[model samples]
Every structure is written in structure tokens, then in C-alpha cells.
Target: MTQAATSDTNVLDLSTCDSEPIRTPGSIQPHGFALSLAEDLTVLQASENLAQHIGSAAAGAVGLPLARVIGDTAAALVVTELAATRVLERPLYLGTVCISETCYFDVLAHRYDGVLMLEFESVERRASADFRNLYPLVGEFLLKLNNTVSTDAMSALAADEIRAVTGYGRVMVYHFDHDGHGHVIAESLADGYHSYLGQRFPASDIPRQARELYTLNRIRLIHDANYTPARLVPAINPVTGAPNDLSFAALRSVSPIHLQYMRNMKTLASMSVSLIVKGKLWGLISCHNETPSPVAFERRTACEQLGQILALSIESREDASELQFRLDLRRIMVSMLGGLTQGADFIDNMTSVFPALLTFARASGVAIVVDDRLLTYGDTPSDEQIRELVGWLSIRAHGDVFHTDQLAAGYPGGADITRNASGILALPISRIHKHYLIWFRPEVIHTIDWAGNPHAKEGAGPLDQLTPRTSFSSWRETITGTSIPWHKGELELALEFRTALLGIALERAEQMAELAEELGRANKELEAFSYSVSHDLRAPLRHIVGFSDLLLESASNEDLEKRHRFLKNIKESARLAGKLVDDLLSFSQMGRAALRPSTISMNDLVHGCIEKLAGDTHGRDLRWEVEDLPEVRADASFIQLAVYNLLSNAVKFTSQKESAIIRIRAERHPHENVFHIEDNGAGFNMDYVHKLFGVFQRLHRMEDFQGTGIGLANVRRIVERHGGKAWASSVAGQGATFSFSIPKELPV
Candidate 1:
């Protein structure tokens, strides 16, 4: 009674072909269907069929009664089996099950009246004598090794081991997409073949039918395209009892174009070891044979065993990817933190520190939240634009990189911004961190040429573009990897990163508020300090001057010589201290003073300086040649101070000369016309010249030059405040020249 029974398909019947059509405890048969039974063989003689196939004598125990033969508990399962073959007239799939006490074959049953015949199919008992049969050992090795190091290098290392273990023409680690578009990403080919390193293919060639079955089933073996099918009873689906074998190669009537394509790709027999990540398909480890060849039973078994571990290894790689992303993030944040302290540009600093970030994030351009007028370098956004975008980002509360799609969701009101842009990444810049590192990625548009007419070839094995995707359509969906929804865990992890960033933004806001408060307090303290110093020092200055006069007038004649000398020294010291305090007060006041611009004649100013000096001290022989001078807009008092300081310095330093030769001239450089007070003086080291204009930075000793060092500093302060710079050029024991410029007003 071993017959392929196809009585009525396309019709579902709940009516029992056997007794009662009993439900299998948890099963509801309304959704369940029945199968027709195999007929015309002696019920007992059928015992040989089960015995010869299952290698168990108890299979012969048929027709002894349903309970004695298979037991009543298995009744519904057997009913499922009968419905399968009877309705479909082809093979069926049954869940894992047991038959006689000693033997098991996943049972697929069909019955007629009191008569019942059941078929058992092997789940996977293709074990062979080889090292690969011990999967447990390899699994442990992979698990232990994964913790200490990366598997990519280890996988390459395993090439020799894998080749020695499984003899195939070429063993490649083929990566696959969620849609089953696969490519041979890594391979160990013998030689003499085109490399498939960066090649891609269509998912439809594998077909939805094939990809779905790959996870539920593993260890596919095609001895040859021409290999004859082994004789066996067929089965139907357990749920629907439809023709069951869903294997890709099992399509006996598959297109001839597909067969040729497999051959064209130089595959005689192939065994693909699947690398599944999560429940979604990730990639594969496919082994190919160029010639018509068969994988030995052991090698096939080993490949399958190897696949199980590789699948799990691929799954755990998610955590590895996350960890690396975090490490890179930490490194970037640390670099940004360092820039804040060192006064470096945040974006540029991060670029040098995280060089691979561009490639990792697929960024075409990176920008920071910056003001163009304030930041003179890099592709800084204009102040007007920056202020607007910053306000928008703050209002919308942007935190992470967003695909163009995300803007529609993040800011529904920001639809116009989204339309103008392809993608935007918003990184926060906090006032507490002055470097304010924020990263922006502008979408780089790629003008991809569609295979314009995709599917120029069909009937190609695993090479046809099937399903909704076509070469003619835009491939934006595939590039994003966003078409298939993210797993719950992965989406949650992405959300966690956003949560961390939100925390940072809130902390930044608080820091900014605190900074504002601190700035106000500092201003008050500075005003109080300035006022106290001014008031407290003036009384002592007046008393010192008054006492010095009294001492000079009242000293006794006998002690007049010594008393006069001491009194003179005290008077000089007191006057100098008083002058020092006045200079300090002036420096403080200059910080808050507004500019008073005037058209000052440079020649008039130099002449005025010479006349003042001439009146102050008896004339020394000097060569004072004033060149034609340009009228410059400047503060009149500050310009006088500049000329006075320069004249005073030249006069004092050149005092030692029997005939001092001082030259006053003006010359032009890139931006401004500089006037100089040049003199052959006792100059200092050229290297320390930069420190010359700073307060208390006089080159001459106090006894050598009877003047305070504040004069040159005051000159520099005034020059800078006039929107120009003051500098001196000199060599030790040689002459010196003091030059200053008043910058021209710039256009707004």
C-alpha cells in the first residue's frame, strides 16, 4: 500500500479519512486538513518497507491495531500525515517525531478506513566518521576565541584548516543581504578564475522560496545538476499538507536557463554553509566545486556543523560593532575635550584624531555649529545662518545623525529644512566646553546609473533579480539598509545612544546658565577692586609729596648734606610709586574707554613730539627728518602718546651718544603705513624683542635709564586699541627702531 495518493487537492476537508479525525491536544483541526492514504500492498508486507528503510524490525508491526502499532497519542499527527500525501499526491513535511520504541523517523501519516499507513523521514542523520562530526569541540573553541580577539583574522587563519577538513574546489565566505542578494566577499580559490571580491547579485535568483527554507533547514547538497533523485516516498506540508520539499534544487522542473547559469558560474556541485545573524539572514559560507563532483557525506556534515557556529558568531558580532562604535565615540569626545582646553578648532581637532570617521559614518562632508565671522577658517557656516540653524536645532532638540527620512519625523514643522537637505547630523556644542565639538554630515548625492534595464538576463541561477526589486528601480532602499525594519534590540540600542546625547544636551544647558551667573559676579567684583585701589592709593601719594617738601625745608644745616641726599631719594621713590599707581589706573580705565577718532596729521604729530622734548631737555644734536605723512583716523591723545613714547625712548637710549642721530620716517607694508622713531641705541637681544612692549620689560637697568618701563607698554596698548600694532626691531649693542600703525577702517 505504498502509493502516491492525490485524490483531491485545492480542497480542504476536516472530515476524517480515518476514525474521528481526533485533535492533537493543542491542535485545532478546523485550520487542519486531511490527506489520502497509499493503497494496494499487504498491510503486514508493508512491514518490510518500514523495516528496510528505518532499519528497525518493529516497523513491520502494522495493522495490529492503531494503538498496538503506533499508539492513540500519535493519532492526530498521523492524521496530518495522511491528509498531506492523499490531498497533494506528493511529498509532505512533518514535525520531528518518533515511531516504534527503538526507532524514529519524523512521522508523516495517512489513513483509509481501519487501514493506516505512515511514512518516516530522516530529520538529519547523515553523520559520517570525520573530525567535523565533533561540532561541540569546534563550538567551544569559537566561543572562547571570540572573547579574546576578533574572528575576521581568525577566519582567514582557518582557511587551511577548513580546506584540509572539507575538500572543495573553492571555499568562500559569501555574505548575503536580508533579501538574499549574495556575493562571495572572501574566498580561498585554488587558482585560475576571476575574483568575485566586490561582485553583487540579485536576491530573486535564490528566490524567496529558497531563502526561507535555508534557516529552517541547513546542509544543502547537490551532487551534480545531473544527479538522479534517490527513490523515496514524498510528503506534504504539516499545516496544509501541500507538496513539502521546498529546496531550491528540488524543483525538478526548474527553468533550463537557471541550470545553465549555475554551470556558467562554474559550479558542478556546491555546498553552502549558512551564516545567519539573529532571525534575519546576514550572510553565508559557500563552498563550490568547479567540476562535476560530490561532497563526501562527512564533509557535508562538517560544513553543516561549521555553519551553526559561524551563524552564532555572526550574531554576536553586533555587540562587537557596537563596542567599536563606542570606542571611536569616546576617542572623538576625548579629542574634543582636549581641544576645549588647548584652544583648538573642535571639528579640525576631531578630524585628525578620528581619521577613519568619514568612511565609518559614510559622511561626505562634516560641519560644526560655528559662526563664520568669529571663526575665520574652515567651511564655517555664516553667522546669520549659524544663528538660525542653531536656534532651530535647539528648538527641535536634535541629538544624532539622521537620514533624510528622519527629519520628516524629528521635526514635522521643519519640513522645509528637510526638503532642502538630504540628511543632517546634529551634535551638541556646549558653552562649558568652549571648543564646542559638533559634527554635521551633509548627504552626498550619488548619480547611480540603474542597470537601467535590470534583468537583462534571466533563467540564471541565483543571478536573476526577482521580487519587488528590479535593476530598473532606484536602489536607495538597499543602500540605506533601512527597508527591512531594525530588530527590537538594535532599535533599542540606537535609542539608548540618543538618550545619552539628550542627557549631555541638558547638562550643557545647565552649565551655560551657571556660566552666565558667574560672569555677572565677576564683573561686580572687578568694579569693586578697581574703585578700592584708586581711592586707597591717592591719600598716601599726597602725604608723601607733602612730607618730602617739609623735610627739605626743615633739615638742620649741620646735617644738611646727608639729610638732603636721603630726603631726595625718599621723594624720588614716593613720586615713582605715585606714578606707578597712576599708570595702573590708566591701564584699567582704558579697558572700558570708548574710542575718539580724529584725522591726525602724522608730520604735525612728530614735530610736536620733537618740540616737547626740546623744551623738556637741552638740545642734543639729532638728525630728525620727517617724511611726507598721510592723515590717519585715530584717537588724538593716543597718537600723541605713541609719538611721545617713541621720542622719549629714542632720546633716553641715545643719551650716551656724543651726537645722537635719530631718524623719524614712515613706510608702507601690506596693510598700513608705519611711522618709526629710529635711533642708534644700546639695543637688547633680538630674540627677546617680543617681550619688549610688555609692562616692566625694559632692557636697560633703572640706574642706566631714569624712567619707568610702563611708557612703551602704554604706547602698545594705545596702538592696539587704535586698531593697529606696535613693534620694535633691534640687535644687541646696535640701533633700535620703534614702529606703529593705525589700521584703516574695514568695510562691514
Candidate 2:
């Protein structure tokens, strides 16, 4: 046998296919009855051969009077023989039946007044071990076949495998249009055979009656189309009064006309496996054989297995498509969430990241819907258009995906209006009530090589429609699943993200408003504090100066001792009180001043302080030990004040000493700048060092070391304002080191 054989040669058999376990014909006689499903599962066609074998009188006479023809006596024997499996019904059954020439027929009995052929083929009495192991294996296989990435690929692959398995010359994947017509979407043909890859067939060929019967059972085989029996119709129908139609129950047959049509196409013995979906016939597996041959019971059984695999694969593919869709949406949502920044700039940049989303919700053009009315369209519609659309959508907007194949008569329920709207996708898009997003597609007279003509589809009267939708009467019904649908979750999520941006913007604006208010309050308080210092505290200091001066003036030169003592005490007390007031002012000012930091040389500042003090003091030998003070970034005036105060205090405290030692030095450390003013003079106890930098907190009495006590506190405030620290280490009567820090770095 050639690896690849032509359709004109000997018939190529797949009975020994290496890809699958081989199955042969059954032990029972090959001769059997025929049942072709059709006409709402009720119409059963029984052949004359079948009628006679079942002990019926005639062909057409048996169908209309089935209970009478397949009599209770024969029926009882048949039912009793195959009673373990199925339940006889008004036209529905669950299991198979066996009918051989020897045993009295029990399983298949027909009751009809309809348009299809219904029969129960023989049930396998002795189940094989190979068949027993198939349940779980096939279940798992079906489960996996449904999970393939591309449903189209799975469909094609299944068609190829099924053709090989069933010995069919050509196996095709057929997709049924809404009008019940079918198109061959994919096909696997024998070498040299012309393929029907994209052929279209009308619903009239299959008829409404033929498609309805596919659901009762799935596999159909017309082994010999030219010779099979025609169904027996007792009176043709209820109107035809007399013995009429043929009985085809026993013999497998096809119509002469259909046979001629097949012969014209150069094919024979066509068999199809129904592809049922969501309780409707979506399509079928159509197979054709060029040669006259019988697809025996064993081959039919094998084909059944392959058909099951195809069903499982299609279902799995559909499920995967849905799952992938959800995952993609979830990922997009997460990305949109992450794009939220402090401002809309983050979101703006993210638009390019997902350029396709805005169009996910595209329109032929968009129209805004308000109050169940059209407000504006792709570029804002006129008042007339809005009113018209609103009226149309108002009638259908209670959570339904609406479409209009023909709007030549305008919207439904409102007469006297005419317009051609080839398609409409109106989704109520609004966070609030009475607003919507409507999309419109006008009849563009585009070419559609479909039912009516293989040319442009032009707009016409109300009856004109497209493929799968023959006329306006069945337009909506046929296009039930065709639309750019709005998912509830997706719409809600988009709204939520848009709202979240506005929320962030609002929060930032609120923060700015609050900061302005606080700034205004701070300005008013500083003004009040400055006023109090200038007015209330200054008056008392002025009085002290005047009275002390008068005391000095009134005393004569001879009373020098008493006058000197009184004036000294007055000046000292007044000076201290004045200093106290000044310190208070400085403390208050520190809080208001913004820190202006800069690099300053401490050695220069120290020298300057010493020069000013030296101008006031007479010559007294004092060695100044000033180290190489490094530069520090700090407020210049503040650092000067701190150094001056420390140096001045040291000068005063050492006035009584014979030789004063005052030192200004800086030590470099890894993290901070440290400056120390060490003086050998009066120093306080280590325990009193804690009070060194506090306001008006002095460890030494005025009689020993004089100070306003605010100097160290001022130094602490200044250093801290520059984000540094100030502290003093002192020992009683030995020495004191007043150390402060200037931080090394700046804040953001």
C-alpha cells in the first residue's frame, strides 16, 4: 500500500491506524435498521425493510400509528430483552438497544407525527475490557483537549485525526450560521481530492426539520446513499389522506435527488457527527467518501470515540479562551492601579503602555447617552440625532446588549421614522443615572460574499438583511450573540480607577489649603510676640536707667564711696534684668527665623570676638589657644553670637585671675563637626552642668560669674535651628569646655 494514496485508487482504510488502538467489526450480523435524527426529535423515518422485519404491515402506515404497527406483543418482547438500559419516551432516551434477526426486537419503538427518524441501535451486551478502561481515560483526554491554546487549531487537528480514524476521505469542521446553514471551516482530504475548504450550504438543504433531530443522538452514517430506504410516512402528513410515504426503518437510505447532488460533487456515503453547543446546534463534523463503502458498526464505534474527543477539545478550547480573557483583564487592571502616582502624570504616561484599551471600547463612532437619550456622538451629535437615539435606546436599556441590523424603519415602537443603521452598540456608560455610551455603524454597502450576493451589501427596505439573518423578522433573534458587549466588572473597574485619580488630586489640593491656613496663623502670632517685647518689656528697662542716673547725679563728690556702691548695685541689677528681657526676645525670635546656613570660619569669629572685648579691657596677659578650626556650614550670625557669648563669658569669669587661658578649637569627627571653647576660669560642679543651656538658668551666682543665663540657651537654639546640638562639660574650679556641633550634611 502506498503511504499516500489518491482518491481515484483503491479505498484507503484507517482500520490499522498506528496512532490509535484498532477496532474491527462486531460479531453480530452487519445488516441493521437505520435511524436518521431530524424534526424536533419526534419525526422517525422507518424503511419498508425495517417495518417488515419489526413485523409491521407496511412502511408509511407504521409511523403515524406506531403503537399499533410495532404492536404491544412484539414491543414487550423487545423491551423485555433490552430492559436493563433505557426508558421509552415521548421521543427522548438515554441508552442504546440491540435488534438482531434472531431475537425478537425489544429496544427500538417509534411514536411519530413529526419530521425526523428516531431509532435505538443495538446495545453491546458483552462489554469488553478495553471499553471498560476507556471511561476515565477518555474523560481526562476530553478535559485536556478543551485546554488547547487555539480553538481553531484544536478543531482542525481533531478533524484530521477523525478522518484518519474513521476511514473517511474528507473530514470537515462545519460551523453553522444562525439561519441554520453550515460552512466547511476546515477539512482534511485524501491526496489528490479537491477540498471543500470554504464551501457554504443553505439551511433549505438541511431544513429546520433535519437540524432538530441531531440532538437525540450524535453520530449519523449513510453507508450507501444510492440504495438506502426512504422513511415511511403513512399519509405523507396529516393533510394527505391515504397510504403514502416510504418506510426506511430497516434499510439505511438516501434520497435520489440528494444522491445525484452528491454524485455531481463526486462524493458518496456522507456521514456527520453533530457538534452541539449550549443546547443549540452550532455545527457538525461533515465527512465524505468518494467510493461506495460501508462504515460498519465497529468503525462507527471508533468514530464515536473520536467524536467524543473532538467534543471535549472544543469545549476545553472555549473554556481556555474565557479564562485567558479574564486573566488579561485582571493584568490590565493591576497595571492601571500601579500607574497611579502623586499626580496624573503617572497615569498619562501609562496610556501608551496600554494603547489598545481605549479602543477596546470603540465605536463606529461614539454617542453619549443621557437620561436614556443620546446627548452627543463621536464628535457630539445634533439635537435631532440625540432625541432619536435616546428614544430608541430608552425602550431597550434595562441591562441588555442591544443591536439593530436594520434601522431603515428607525427604532422599534416609534413609527413614522426611517433610517438605515446597519449596526448599533449602545451601552449605558455612566457612573450616575441617565447617561450612556452609544456606538453606531451606518450601512456602508460593504462587500460580503454571503447568502444574497457575493457583492456589496447595500441598504434597502425593512425586509433586507445579511447572512445568518435572512429578513428583518428574524434579525434580532439571529444576532443575539453579536455585539460589542460591556461587561459589568470591566465597566465598574474603569469607573473606579478614574474616580481614584480624582480622589488623589483632591487630597493633594486639600493639603495645600491646610498649609496656607497654618502659614497665615503663624504670621499673626509672630507679629504679636514682637509687639509685646518692644512695648511692655522696654518701658521698665528705661525707668531703671533713669532712676539709677538720678541717684548718681544727686550725690556729691565727697560722698563717693556711698554713691559708688549704690550706683554699682543699681547698674548690676538693672543690667541683669535688661539682659533677661533681651534673652527672652532672642528666644522668641529664634522660632520665627528661617535657618540660612553657610560655611563659616570659627577661628575668624573667635578672633573678632576677642578684638571687641580687648577694646574694652585693659592689658592683662591672657594666652589664646586657638586650634586650626575647620569650616562649618551654619547660619553665620548665629554662630558668631554663640562664639561671642562663650568668649565674653570666659573673659568676664577670668577677670579676677592673674593669667587667663581661653581656647577656641574644632575637632573633626566622622559624622559631625565639633567645636569647643575651653576656658580655665570659674567652672560649675558636674551636677549643675545639666542646667548649662537652659533659658535664664545659671549655675554661677552674679557675685562670682555674671551672665544673662540666656546665652547658652541661645547657643543651643541657634545650633539646633541648623539641625545641630550644643552641650557643656564643666568641673568646679578647674575648667569648662563649651562644645557645640554643626551637622555635616543637608536635608533634602
Candidate 3:
């Protein structure tokens, strides 16, 4: 079934309605004889000229067993092979059969619509086993094809080979474009013959149905363009009372319109072999002769095999080229990713990275719109024009990627931009913000030479038959407002690049959030520390000052024991103030430290931390349980510091317990690894968990825990810096489990 006719102006005006029905023509070329049989092998019909060879009246042959019409021996042979004839429209050669004592004919059989049709043609005298000589020639032809690296080279070589082998007056390799229109890419002609090379033919010249038949039947041969079509006896089959479908018949008659087309070209004989690639019609190996030149069956078979070999070579070469192209693009993309990491901000460094991106899509210019910042590189449109184009794309673009060669056709006021960037391949990184990465292609003006005037009309025939263009003169057309169209590979690369760019944008956003949080916390900590220093330090200083002043005044009068007590109180207050300052300095250093990430074993890091904190755990009845932990990519010093803080807190808070229990293990999540340290210690209230990881925020009294409330805060900062998070869960009296998660796979 065919689709409904489209009203697109560019569509070919092929006379679809008036075209002859070539498939079910109910006729055969006079060069061969045809006969039809019923399910029981009874002759139901025969060609009008059957009696000339078989000495039997065509009418009298009907209703007779095929054995009586031909011969018992020949009929038995045909029946034996009929059972294996499964493919419709594919004829099976049944060898030669003697029609009479003086004549022998080559027999071909095919089955259609439950009826068997057989064709017989006179066997021409030829050199015995002539096909055997074509094997080496075909081998050489294939070798030549294999050595050719490009499609055009292969096409040229094929045309030359076919012309040499078939001895035809002209042979051309006609290639079909994305549209059904064809052009002779390569041609070889005999002396005094005009060339059709580089000439474009409209799609209507071949019609849709004709192209379909080409795929079904790989080779079509018209021995003589002007030969009369032989009428089948009864015209329509007796059993079905309809025209015979001569689609697969070797001697099928040509359509009248097509014959007229051949006459218009002034060609006497023609042959076409389908050049199929990847199971679709790629083009045709068209052979035309200035005179009636019938190619022998053996030579035609060789030509068919050659076309098949060429198709395989074409597919292989194209695949290899595409693979190499993708590899090159991937290499360029990798370089672009490396460049993305050169600067701290992705958007700020867009101009520096723009050149690599433009090279990726082979575009003349590029425009990157990340949020409000728009950056242009190379020969780009004006700032106003770019903004306008981006605004248009914001509303009209579909999916994550949008591309067009004729940009002006889609966007109003885009023609000005098209002067430099006629084509645009745009990828939106953020839909909400309308962040985009666009590559631009400049206009490429060229001329197309049609075989005949496309707009001219010669005359109309009966039934409003669409007449073929009468003139063979070249008609040139200059095209504008377009750029070289983007290739499929380029589009695929753009999509891949889009994914990478989006990832970078997301990482940048995350880094910005982390910075903002760090800055905000620093400001709050500065304010809190200012107040704490004034209040907490003043109280300690007051005690030291009051004790020292009292001791100094009464040094001469006070007893030795009272003086010693005063001095001791002063020393204790000074030590407390000094310790607070040291803790504050350590907390500040944790925020300023640079991260050096490497693959380190958590088990080893935890053990090292425990060894360092041995003094705190000495002489205590502590039961330490450490499970096997996986290795992770992180800064060794930072992770160690976090572990040390958690472990020390567990030992300090559990000092009152007769026996303390601590456990360390790691749990795996889909995207991250979570490590936990649990202790059966003085757990804090769940209500105060929100303040647990804050700077200088303590859940327990300072006298009870002996901490500056900086341990958990440092752990949180370290985890956050490594693209992870930290939290704790506990009951009031049970144990607290402190856990931090790190991403399993780090991004590039």
C-alpha cells in the first residue's frame, strides 16, 4: 500500500495515475514463449505463438495435461522442481527442453496465485561454458573495488568494469540522494556518445512503483527498446479471469510510458542492476546502448554478481569510515572536557573552550548561552542577532537538540544572522534557565545542473499524461539561504557533547552551592566566635586576675598554703583559656586546608587514627569492633582527622561506663559509600541533632564531655568538601552512630 499523496511543492509530479501497470501487464516480450498451468498441472493457457514450435494449436492445448502439451519427460522434470519453487517472482531455470526435433529452448518456471507459469525462449548458439571465463574477470573487478577507499572511486571503477565486461556503448553509476532524485556520479561512454555525468534527473523520471520493483528484481534488462510485446493467449488467465502478473517473468513486457521514456532518451537497449546497500536501494548500475544490444544470460548473471559484491564493499567502507569519524570526535570531546577543568568557573571560561567545541561540530562559529552570560567565538553573528536567535530558539526548539540548515526559514529576522551563520545546531543545557550551546555554519552557495528544465511543460497527452521533459539541455539553478547540511555523525557528536556540558554545568552549580554554604557558615562562625571570645575568655581572665591580685597583695602576710591555692587557681584559668584558643585555631585550619584525593583503604586509615589516639584509650576497658571496610578515593589526612574526632568523642563520652564498646563499618548505597562509627557512649538528645554538626555547638556540658564542640563540625566540613555528607543518629542513653557518605565514582 502507498501513502496518501503529499502536497509539498518539492514533491515530483510523476504521472502516478496514468503510468502503465508493469507488474500485471498480462503480456510478454515476443522474444520468449509463455504458458500457464492449473493446480493439477493442466495447461490452462499458452502464448499465441506456441504452435510455431510445439506443432499444436494454442486453443487446443488448453485443458490438457502439461505432459501432453510439452512432453512426458519435460513435464515430469518440471513437476519435480515445482515443489521446491517457494519464492514468488523468482524464476527457477529448469534447463533446456526440446520443443521439436529442430529446436531446443531454455525453460524457466515460477508459481503465482496458485498457478504455475512457465516461459521458454530459443537457446542461442554460443561458446560452450563461456561463463567459466567470467569468474577471473569478476575476481579482478572485486579486487579493484576492494582497493578503492571512497564511494566515488568505487562507483567510477564499477562503471568502467561493467562497460569493459558488457561491451555496452555506455555505462553509468547513478546515485540517489536523500531525496529520490538521481544523478550520474560516474559514467563511461563509447566513441561519439554524449556523457550524462554530473547530470541530475528528477525522481518522477523513475516513479515510486518502478523503484520498488528494482529492489524485488535486482536486475532489469530490456533487450530491445522498440521490440513488440507478445500477447498472452486469452490475455487474462482462464482460472482467475484476471491479467497475469508478469513481475518475475524474464520476458515481461515493458510499460508503454517507460518505453516512451526510453525513446525520448533515444536509447535502443538498456539494462539496470540494483545497487543495494544495507538492504535498501542505494542506486543503479545503468547500462544503455545506442543500438539494440542483447546481453547474454551468462554475462548478465556476472553483472548481477558484480553489483552484489559492490553493495557489500560499499556497506563495509561506509561503516569503517563512520567508525573512524566517531573515534576522532570522541578524541576531540575528551580534549574539550580536559579544557573545561582548566578554569574554576565553566561559564567564565566558555570563550576559552569555545574553539574546541566549534571544532567538534565542524562549524565556523559557536555561541554559548549559560544563564545570563552569552559568549561568542570565531565569526559569529552580532550580539543583538545572537540574542534574537537564542530568544527564538527558547520558544521554538524541540527536545534537547535542534538543528536546521535554513535558519532564516524558521526564525523571522534570522536572515541577517544567516549571512554568516546560515545553519545552526543548538543544544539546550538547562531548560528552565534556557542555557544553550550552539554551533553555527556559514552559507555555502552552489549551483545544481538539472538534465532538463524542471519548470518547463512540453505538452499534455491523453488522460493528462505527464510528459517527460523533451529537452536534454543542461539547466543550472543557483541555491542560496542554505548552508552545508550537518551529517548524522555530527549530530550524534553534538548530543554527546551536550550531555558532557550539562554534567559540567551541574558540577559547577554544586560547587557554587558548597562555596556559598562555606561562606555563610564562616560569617556566622566569626560572629559567634567574637561573642564567645569576649564572654568565655573574660570569665577565665577575671578569675586569673582576681586570684593573682589577691595573691600579690597578701604575699607578705598570707600563709604558705593559702598562697599556693591562689597561684594554682590562676594557672588553671590560664591553661583553660590557652586550650580554647588552640581548639579555635584547629577549627579554622580545617576550613582552609587543600584536599589531596587518592585511593586509600578506610580500614588502614581508621587503624592509623586509633593508634594516634591510643593515649585517650589507654588503661580503659574498651571493646573495639572494626569490620572490613572498602577502599575509597579521598584525602587521607582529612578522612583520618574525621575518624580521629569521632573515635575520641566516643572514648571521652563513654569514660563513665565500666566497659565501652565501639564499632566501625561501611555501608554501600547506589551512588555513594557510607561509613559508620558507632559507640555505646553518652549519646546526645535526638532533639539537638540539628545543631550537632554546627561550629562550637555542643549537646553536652563542657565539664561532662571535655570538648570544644569542634570535632563533629570538622568531620562535616571534610565530608562536604569531598562531595559527600555526614550525619549522626542516637538515643539519649544508648549509643550514637556517626556516618558520612562519599560518592562511589568521581567525575572527571
Error of 2 at 461 (Å): 23
Pairing residues by index, what is the TM-score of model 1?
0.39
Counted clashes in each candidate structure: 17, 33, 0
**Per-residue lDDT of 338-394 in model 3, one digit per residue for the tens?**
888789878776667777877888899988876668888988898778887888889
Candidate 3 lDDT at 88 equals: 58
In the range 345-378, model 2's lDDT, one tens digit per residue, is 4324334433333343333455544454333434
Residue 304 displacement in candidate 1 (angstroms)? 1.9
TM-scores for the candidates: 0.39, 0.42, 0.84
- Number of colliding residue pairs in model 2: 33
By the TM-score metric, which is better: model 1 or model 3? Answer: 3
| CA lDDT of every candidate | 0.52, 0.56, 0.81
- Candidate 1: worst 10 consecutive residues by lDDT? 23-32
Q: Rank the candidates by lDDT, best first.
A: 3, 2, 1
Most lDDT-accurate candidate: 3
> Residue 596 lDDT in model 3?
82
- Highest TM-score model number: 3
